[model samples]
Target: MFTSAAMFFNGAEEAVEFQCPVQETGLTATIEELMSLLQEGNSNSNSGSPNSGSEGSNGRGVYSLDERKRRRMTSNRESARRSRWRKKRHLEDLTEEANRLKMENRELKNRLGLVAQKCYVTWRENERLESESLALWARLSDLNQVLVAMQTMRSQY
Candidate 1:
């Protein structure tokens, strides 16, 4: 009946190990579970035995009320500190991402402006070419008419 009690502190990979002398105790739990059980036992002992006050021993150890409260407060403070650090890191990540995106957007906008200018220049050139082509066609038509007139005069003579 080998029971393992693994207690992780602050999300660390290392665990606190505790060995029990009794083989059939069969107690496999974490530190949190042990703490909850102790608290429950403390409450029950206080309720059942009115003589047991804040400093009463619960056969395990002499964990006074003040000591338990202090430990709980310390744990809570550590948890809060870790939470704040995580939040700060998350905010920093978001800020960095926003700056990166802004830079990309600025670059894209500059590229779009350059492309629009090129398109405008090409459109102007196309219009100019079309106008020149129409003018050349008109000139060619006039030349053809003059040639026909000269041919008709020669035939009359």
Candidate 2:
């Protein structure tokens, strides 16, 4: 059982030999005690306690306090850099949209001016045609009266 427990921790298939006497009845209690001790050690290390060995010589495999702090600072700087890049990209997109909208507005205003000019020209032409039509109708009426008077004089003679 001790060999099995050690293999679980090691995550390997190679059989481990234990010299200590481990009874089946005490297995659960032993596992629990081991887990508690591991938790306590992790907490102490994270809290930078005196027993956690803040000195450069923490262990052969463990990182020193200064190294861990440097790694955390580097990760934070990278995260902040990425956030700033995203913000800059978003701002650039908004600026591009604003520029496009301004150009479109100017084009629409120019088209409106052209339409207004065309409408004024068409209105003046309509008014001139209407005045010419009235003048032609009055001339036709006077010519009809002259023709009727000539026919009456020819018939009397």
Candidate 3:
């Protein structure tokens, strides 16, 4: 089934990831296509003419099981290292964003407290001015009563 995939594709999908599957002969078509491309690429890359080792009549070099296992282990280790580095970078970014938000929140609370204090001071000043105005009006009324009494006594005389 994998060999048949070479007919539909030009063997350049090795770097691509597989997601959905298309069913043909009850087999996942994308997996078959990916495997075919990867195998072709591997065969092409390893086809260098080797003078130190025997080359088969098919122009391909023979590979040992130990060499294949070593390559697989190396690839796995590199992949794991990169994955760890990415996770660490992501955590650092999140921590920095949280710190910035906390600083902004603190500044806003301080400004709110200052505004509330100013409002209370203005209210107290207005209340003091209102009481002073009432006291002045009462004194003026008492002076008017004394003037009226003096005018009445002069008229009696």
Over 25-117, each residue of candidate 1 has an lDDT whose tens digit, in order, gives: 434345446755755564444443323243333434334465568888999999999999999999999999999999999999999999999
Clashing pairs for predicted structure model 2, backbone only:
none
Per-residue accuracy of model 3 over 42-107 as CA lDDT, tens digit each: 555444433223234465444445555677799999999999999999999989999998999999
TM-score of 2: 0.54
Best by TM-score: 1
Model 3: how far is 69 from its true place, Å? 3.7
Q: What lDDT, from 0 to 1, does candidate 3 have?
A: 0.65
After best superposition, candidate 2 residue 138: deviation in angstroms? 1.9
On the 0 to 100 scale, the lDDT of residue 151 in model 2 is 97
Number of backbone-clashing residue pairs for each candidate, in the order shown = 0, 0, 0
Pairs that collide in candidate 3 are none
TM-score per candidate, chains pooled = 0.57, 0.54, 0.45
Better of 1 and 2 by TM-score: 1
Cα displacement (Å) at residue 59, model 3? 12
List the global CA lDDT of all models: 0.67, 0.67, 0.65
